[model samples]
Target: MDWMHEHELRRVNQIKLSLPSSGEEALAARERIQKRIAARRAARTPAAA
Candidate 1:
């Protein structure tokens, strides 16, 4: 079980390391997603309120 966990962790780390986005691109994507999520939440709240 421990070995399986270690293998999975290594695989995940490798994939993360290999991803194409530079730090700025990742941050920009995250910010865009957060803004979209916040806008959706705001839209839902007033209707429910």
Candidate 2:
């Protein structure tokens, strides 16, 4: 179990290190995240104010 956790941590760190530093890749990722959040909000029912 401890070994699995260490392997996962290392994998996550490697993925983070490989991510885009700046420019279009980062911008696109940000935009996609924003759109996902907006979609989630739209899907939820609004409560009476």
Candidate 3:
């Protein structure tokens, strides 16, 4: 009955898909965050040649 429709299921599945569900996925997410932090830092300072 309810399983026939995908309204709520679709929303929940989207949330689940966005989460890091494994160690490798979690590591990748962490690396991405670190890269963002480094980029911000790099943007705020003068570079030396």
Candidate 4:
């Protein structure tokens, strides 16, 4: 989880630096990263009995 968070942070930073003019673009990037991370976590967890 720590690694995943770090990776997401890195991606966010990259997006921020690459396009410093658009807040909306940054927000969209963050949302996409978050959804991907959430989906990965959900897939890794065991199903309830």
Candidate 5:
């Protein structure tokens, strides 16, 4: 809902740049952020389950 559309979430989820270079940069940044989030999520999951 509204919480999911927050600025930080929008920024991480979408690449809304005007130039190609800018878009690439945003994509790279988003990837890095996503990797970190994924790593954290994985670490939180229990291995036995």
Candidate 6:
């Protein structure tokens, strides 16, 4: 519904507004994201013989 789309847009805008603005905060965010990606990749990849 149109209301759902509008609600999601507002949520996305709020998230954008809350994002870290400092370099250190940005670096910490990047590290957390990388760790999550690595964990997901490790889970999906088959073990070597």
What's the C-alpha lDDT at position 14 in model 6? 97
The prediction achieving the highest TM-score against the true structure is 1
> Better model by TM-score, 1 or 4?
1
Please provide, for model 3 over 1-49, each residue's C-alpha lDDT reduced to its tens digit, 9 standing for 90 to 100: 4664688888888998888679878899999999999998888765641
Candidate 4 CA-lDDT value: 0.82
Could you give the C-alpha RMSD of every candidate to the true structure, in order shown? 8.8, 10.4, 5.9, 16.0, 14.6, 10.4
- Taking the tens digit of each residue's C-alpha lDDT, what string does model 5 give over 1-49? 5667588777755664434686788999999999999998898887746
Range of the 10 consecutive residues with the lowest summed lDDT in candidate 3: 40-49
In order of appearance, the predictions have TM-scores of 0.55, 0.46, 0.49, 0.50, 0.51, 0.49
Per residue, candidate 6 scores C-alpha lDDT tens digits across 1-49 of 3667887989988998788768879899999999999998898786641
Query: How would you encode candidate 2's per-residue C-alpha lDDT over 1-49 as one tens digit per residue?
Result: 3666887989988998888777868899999999999988877746422
What is the number of backbone collisions in each predicted candidate, taken in the order shown? Answer: 0, 0, 0, 0, 0, 0
**Candidate 5: residue 48 Cα off by (Å):** 9.8
lDDT of 1 by residue, 1-49 (tens): 3666887989988998888769878999999999999999999999999
What's the lDDT for residue 46 in model 2?
68
Can you write out model 4's per-residue Cα lDDT over 1-49, one digit (the tens) per residue?
Answer: 4566887989988987887567877888999999999998888786632
Clashing pairs in 3: none
Give the local distance difference test score of model 3: 0.83
lDDT of 6 at 49: 19
Could you say which candidate leads in lDDT? 1
